[model samples]
Target: MTQYIGRFAPSPSGPLHFGSLMAALGSYFQAKSQQGQWLVRVEDLDPPREQLGAADSILRTLENYQLHWDGNVVYQSHRHDLYQTQIEQWLSSGEAYYCQCTRKQIKAMGGFYNGHCKPLNHQDPAGCAVRLHIDQPVTEFTDLKHGQITLPQALAEEDFIIKRRDGLYAYNLAVVLDDIDQGVTEVVRGADLIEPTGRQMSLYHQLKQPTVSYLHLPLALDENGNKLSKQNHAPAIDELDTQATLLRAMDCLGFAIEPSLKDGTIEEIIQWGVQHWSISQLPESTEITPRFSNGSV
Candidate 1:
């Protein structure tokens, strides 16, 4: 039987919040339940958005919550050469082309790029981005948690960018490449990213690699119904009370953990969780507001 491999990839844009913690816990529980390897990858590709020391802080929080990873942590910032190599190969094979279209121009075309620059075949690297030529689009895919998901035709067929004009690789390109490099068999993440699954699957097909399984857990929403995310200034998880926060995260993933386990050590609680975790128990809805006995998360 093929070994199951899962990963928790967090970007260093900000500290870990309840939403981020849910993703990490979901991925961790799913992997450990199957006796699979759980790897950690720090996505620090965008220099301008990353916070200094955020990566170390995230790892520390994971450890404090007893979500220990299996191997040496991988950083996207260190894998630029690999992304570039793939882009070069695609460019040579006519699978990708240079694009100079700006966001405003794309918006003018009713929000999705119509591949206006592909025929231009602009060879100059300066002031241009590289886009994947989407001759065969992946319109739909099945999720381990959500079942079959269908994507809009415009979104599925749009020729997306691989490398930005600023020389940074796009998230879809970097994430898919990194997952392939780590031999990740399943990707467990937040439901907010469900839209990108089709695009990532398309990239996998273009690379001649089999698509990995996806399990997008329900998103944690704030009181205002906004997603609890770094961009929304969501407070970081309280590392001081790791037990309570860990329980809240597990609850968000639909685990009815016993109250007695809360008195146990963090490791013990995690062990109990691994034995009890089941993907079928997870909420089918996309968003969920975490419940707390006290007025705090």
Candidate 2:
């Protein structure tokens, strides 16, 4: 049987919160339940949004919860050369091209990039972003939890940027390449990223790599039904109360643990969680308001 390899990648924009913990624990349990390898990747691609010590803080927080990864942590910031090589290959082969269109221009056109610069064939690549020519867009894929997902034709056909004008690699390009490079067989992340799945799957086909199985866990929301995120000022999980945090995360993921385990150690809670983890139990909706005892993470 082929070994299952899953990953929990988080951006270092802030420390791990209850929402982030749900993704982490869900992925970890999913990987461990099958006796597969679980990996961690710090997506520190956008330096401007990354906090100075958030990366290390995330790692320490993971350790505190005993959600240890199988191998060395992969940092996207250190993999620019790899992304650059792929970008060059695509550009030389005409699979991708330079685009000078700004965000404002795209927004004016009903928010879909119309591939205006594809035929430009401009010699000057300076100050331009690299966009993949979506000759054959991916319109559908099956999610492990949500089943078949169909993407809009316009969204799939848009010539999405693979590299930004600021010279930073795009998330879609980097994530697809990284997953392929790491031999990842499954992707377990938040439903907030479900919209980009088709684009990433398209990139997988472009790279001639098989797309991996995906399971987008329901997003955790606050009382106002807003998704918990660093941008939304979600409180960071307290590593000091690792057990409580893990239990709370497990509950949010739809795992039923005994009340007796509330005071249990991290190991005890995790063991129960992994043994009982079931994607079937996850809520069908894309977002869920998580109930926390302390009112916050």
Candidates' RMSD to native? 0.9, 1.0
Candidate 2 residue lDDT tens string, 262-286: 8788888888888999999898898
Task: Please give the range of 10 consecutive residues that has the lowest summed lDDT in model 2.
Answer: 239-248
Clashing residue pairs in candidate 2 (N, C-alpha, C atoms within 3 angstroms): none
Worst 10 residues of 1 by lDDT: 288-297
TM-score of predicted model 2?
0.98
Residues 26-142, candidate 1: write the lDDT tens digits. 999999999999999999989999999999999998988889999899999999999999999999998899998899999999999998998888899899999999888988889
Give each model a TM-score. 0.98, 0.98
Off by over 4 Å in 1: none
Model 1, CA-based lDDT: 0.92
* Residue 124 in candidate 2, Cα distance off native in Å: 1.4
Point to the candidate with the largest lDDT: 1
